[model samples]
Target: MTWILVLVAIGLLSAVLLLRTRRTRQKNEPPLDKGIFPWLGHALEFGKDAAKFLTKMKDKHGDIFTVCVAGNYVTVLLDSNCYDAVLTDTKSFDLTRYSQLLMDRIFNLHLPNHDPVSERKRVNQYFNSSNLSRLCSTMRNNLQFLIASADTQNPTEWKKDTLFDFCYSLLFKAGYQTMFSTENDNTAKFTDVYEEFRRFDKILPKLARRAAARDELKFASSARKRLWELLSPNCFLTGSVTQSWMQTYLQHLKEQGLDTETQRRAMLLQLWVTQGNAGPAAFWLLGFLLTHPEALKAVKAELCSLQHLPLDKTEDTPVLNSVLKETLRLRAAALITRDVMQDKTIKLSNGQEFVLRKGDRLCIFPFLSPQMDPQIHHEPEKFKFDRFLNSDETMFCKEGLQMKYGTMPWGAGSNLCPGRDFAVCALKQVVHMILTQFDLELCDCNASMPPVDANRYGFGMLQPDGDLKVRYKLKKHN
Candidate 1:
């Protein structure tokens, strides 16, 4: 009996060792040109400069390369034709897994498990063009209130206040007002929810250490419990017609047999969808405008002319569209992240083969790189409002300045940001309100909005580092 037990234990140990060895071998066996210490991989260099790491690899290994990160092998695809091949291929790729990774990092919502059909259906309901149109009035009203409440004239106070903080606060207030309009008084409560969310974003990617990772998950769970408590009906949906409407909607969903957790996740999805990228994008637009006098002038001129246009008039505001488009192109929050799921071969227009392996990540970093590409835009570093203008065309065409791989601020294809149109409208209202009523200039002119360090993590997100002094000049009616 003792000899039989010993043999069984030996067999189990041997199997475990073999599995580990196989995984390690697979990790090293990726078919790509890996220069020096491929086992150590690009881990150290990537950790140092994640934004430039891919660019550097592209420089050394041409358009495609395979590198191991965190025990996972990733393939990067670059260059224009390769970009088109992946983006335009609708059926072959899915962003769900990558999107799930981001959701886990940011929201702690325990989402990303729904069937793709259901997920797409739900998201489409929320962000369909008609739904976005329904949101426009709410966004407009919220913007008006924010503008009326902003500290416009006090020069000294404005100078001391952080522009980034002000933008975040404005965005938070507007977002809350728009979503929970008379629905809840727990604006402060929701603010805490978002702060906790941001806290998780700041911490998650750095959780490579197992012990630290466990602690973060523990804290995140506790935060979620607290949030659930605060989000009780009495706290969140109360005291108004909108609240009643939301309650009815939720009840209908429950009657349709959606689980309680799914309902809660759906509510969370609504909250973040409204407040996420648009707010940061707005902040960046304003900050960038402060640096460029010509852009500011163009915006002011366009805004001043729009005073005569009716509120419902959508067309003829060409310059406002220009400002909005330029801002999105220049300073969008977040970058494109996709994992190459198949060992696919991409054929480029230049007659080169870019071979990509399964399970490798191709991250398109938007942190001051794409916006400053000299090859795409002449004098890329300068904030030229007309940089995106179709110079040869007599009419200002929206689609003409577009470059396939060059204009990727909102990403591309089916994964293209759903909230972009709504965001643009919201931002336009904000910019119009500010430019119309306020004389604005950088309060701390020396302060700059630079790329956030990789160690800190909140880069290309709602982070505008600057101070602006804005003074309200009452409109003169003749």
Candidate 2:
């Protein structure tokens, strides 16, 4: 009798779900794929390989289509034609709200829900033209200290290290000290907090699930607590002469009447944001150079030519800048997402229109649409070091067209990343320093490009599935 009742309950649930799905399809929505499972939807398939899945769908259903993933329907715009719609339609689409949702789920904390525009403006001020020169000097000093310290035991021998780990450690320390003060006495304690934060970051996909179990929640909670403890006012505020960017941020939080715990959580998020994309990006940029000998030779020659110029003026090295741009294009799996605040009609450049209802999500996968579009980038799969350089020593473009939204590694419009300028400068400095100060080579010259972690698709930069080993020895002059 119990078995029969269980079967009846399952049957009723399936019937209701079928009816709801039919109703959703009846509306004038983009083509929806619910996949095989009911509520699970296309989450598994989409998670496995986002670019390929989206490409197959785009080929079948034009540039616009919807896919149900974990009970939410997301409409993807997959061509340059629809770029303006995502960038300009800020009134109907809200990126901040979407960002907040992800942050809340992953961190398991409720941040003060407020307009981020003012915050963005304030942060941008810190990275403005006047302040960048000083910041760059600080970063250079930090990088030099890190590299020098690593060779204390045996300076003459080549050190074998994983590029990802080395970059992450160096960047995390440098970025932390640059934004925050370096006066803290508890370096060991802060290092502990950083490790915990990394562990928490790795399990974000599991934690984002609505049905996340207690064990997962417990781990995330513990990590957050440790981070909060380390970033407490007593620890973070002490031992700094000049005012750090974090000090100003803390002051703002205090003025907003947020509690100490909230402020710490906010700081943790900031720490993650500042160093997150940079480490992986630096790794890929250097990795690409190591694998391609011709590109390496050209970039090295460019660096040699610019040796007479001031190291602070990274803009002078246009070839290195082009390589960085290409790396961002190839490695960044940026998923620009917006929540539909109200019902709206989205008209594309190709004369097709779609009605997006309230609560729906609109996303653009730049990895597929623009970055790998052969129409815009010839031989998009291959790494061309000078792809973004022109004969006139200016930025390259597609078919003599400007293409404003063509290469959006940092993003577009009001939603653009505030740390973009700082990130670019930091990457250039790291690469320039590495090339000039060290003699480096891949342990395995035949090692292919590292596979991108598909789960990190929507989170700005894509990380490698695993670390790659490289051998290095300090140059005599450095």
Candidate 3:
């Protein structure tokens, strides 16, 4: 009986080891690091600070290598020159298919008709380039109404709030209104939506890795469900008439034969996608301007000259555009990923060929490459407001390199953000209004830039690690 019990224990141990086993790397493949843990692999370290961890790996393996993260082998391409090897290869690498991994494991939100790949077409149409001016007009109207007279009219008295809170809260409100406005505005309802979104946002990293604690998962689940209820079609049917981008998308979803429940879930997904990055971006842009007096002065001078230009024409305000570009270069972080749909050979521009295994993942982190590489960007740590501009006021030629993509806070390829144009308009409008319409500054003028929330490295538009105290009041002339 004792021998039988001992054999049972050994069998259990053997099964555990079998489940943890990984495949061996073949010759000519990128170097592989399985990390210290069995299944978790480099997940903990990668999550802690992806920039630091990936940088360390790049130092050891040179630009490209494979590493085991969680249970998957992810081939990371840090060479700016080699990004096209993945981004351009439609036949071998597929990002749309790769999105299913996120959907299945983390979100558990089923894509309608099981086809997010084709959903891109619908999304593109909603953000059609031809209607860009109209969308910009809608967003500008919503944004100004949110920030104007009622909140900032008291020019004599200063209002104090942390910069992050102010920026995130306002952008969420305005973006929400543009996409999902109910006829008569309800500040209380907007506040409730923003608060719940913050709750969900705080847990997204853990949730994505499937490491969220029980309570965190529960709260995130509840927050998501509540958001669906708040944005449901019945809310509009009850009397608050509207035809916003969200309404347009929902109408499209309905045409696709999705039920009301499915449409609600899709609305929640839309809310998450459309509203997440803008606020963090606005906060970082404002924070950079507040901390850098020279940049602030340059943007102010540009604003003086362009008082009559349409807010939609951000390109006309070159100084503001340059500063925003500079801020994003330093602050924005995104991970471009594709599923290895087949056993494929990727050849870098330098003629190094690596054969990727089927079932592996390919990743490109531009933030670590051209965005911060000393070769591509001098003084990469410092925010140079004119970095994207030349003395002739022509756009800087990607630091003299013949590059296809540069300063891509928005991604590339077919999946590149559809609303990217609107994003530029919205961010520029916020910065323009704040700088021109009010008296705003850091409460502690000497406060330095806060550390980035490194857990958010692969996520777009990182939030600051801590908040900066700031005060603002409406300008009397405005």
Candidate 4:
């Protein structure tokens, strides 16, 4: 009887383990696949290359399916047409908790009145598309000054460095100065900030996932602390020309009774959000243009004709816009993630329905379908500078399933980036200034394009795994 009882206990324990480790699909749910691993299902494959893994999964199971990843079952939506069902449904979906979770995980940040919705609204008000005159004016001045200051040693002499390093470093400095005012264009000070930022950014993905090893965690923690010190309230307040938005944000934080430390952490988060993507984007845009000679010629021609600060984006430049559109489509890969607030059935625009369970995650990898799918974009992997232009160059190409927005860089609804217009203006500013004000070219024209760092598939701007050597010199102003 004792032996039988022991056997029964073991059997019951095993049953409980199986129940905890596995999942069962209820009616109307998406196709579920819990991989062979007990708790870490398909995490290895997914982490290795999310795009490739998701593509394989899409082939195996239709456009939508739930796969267990790192113990969480995430229902991924691949159909571009169906993204609205997820983005607009505030009652059933929530991203604020997830965003806050990342903040604590990555930045060690916790706010008193942590309301992202209200915060985003205030941010949008500052970054309003209708009136970006102040920010745009400052950004242009900073860009020109920084460009001229970059190589005071030799105006005509060609300076050489890895292109990605040059682009990101310069743009980051300019963007930093534009957002957080400084008494002087202290190149050394801002460059140090960008260096520390780069260090923190490299390990950010692992940090967010709670998967950083000993060395990575140590580096991230140290780098973040240093960043906090650099952008501390004292340093930030001393700046004479702090943007209005910064002033408003600081006042709001103080109203919430946040301490100096909390406010500093908040500033760091803002830095990451505002100054992060533009540089990498500039890198990709310039890299593509340099490699493609005809594209280089066309964009330069367009810049030559511009008579104003903000070129009538509605009518003036088509070639430059197309090139930018192509670059973003190829390089931007953001994983739109949301928490399933309740058990809700999501009906796709195509009329397919799938039930998402409460406590599960919903993921939309637009980079896979709408952005890079060959069916939607012809020769999707190849860079076609004119891919988005009509034959007469009157309208951007919006054929196939792209009845709405062709690419999703800013995402949708409340999660839609308020800084969208400003970011694009910044990119165009960088490209226009670089091409028209400086002479740049690849060191080795025949060398292959650098491979993208696969680890950053879900991150916003996809950085190249390897760097390309490039040379540039200041062009004589007319």
lDDT of each: 0.56, 0.76, 0.79, 0.82
Ranking by TM-score: 4, 3, 2, 1
TM-scores of all predicted structures: 0.75, 0.89, 0.91, 0.92
* Local distance difference test, candidate 2: 0.76
- Model 3 compared with the native: what TM-score? 0.91
lDDT of 2 at 56: 85
lDDT of 1 by residue, 1-478 (tens): 9999999999997785444334332332324534344344566666655556766776676545566654556665544434656765534555667667655555444443544435445545665765665666777877776666554565224334455556666776676666544543555665676676555434444542222456777775676556555444333445454332235445545666766665665555445555656566767788777767777887687678665333445566666666666666555535455666676667744566655556666654443334445555556555567655543222221124344454556655555655566666777777777777666667556656555345422234434433455433435445
RMSD in order of candidates: 5.9, 3.4, 3.2, 3.8
Candidate 2 lDDT over residue span 251-288, tens digit each: 88888898887888888878777777778898899989
Worst 10 residues of 1 by lDDT: 391-400
Off by over 4 Å in 2: 1-19, 24-28, 185-190, 209-218, 239-241, 305-315, 391-402
lDDT of 3 by residue, 253-306 (tens): 777787888778777777878999999999989998999999999888888765
Over 4 Å off, model 3? 1-22, 104-106, 152-155, 236-242, 308-312, 391-401
Q: How many clashes would you count in candidate 2?
A: 0
The per-prediction tally of clashing pairs is: 2, 0, 0, 0
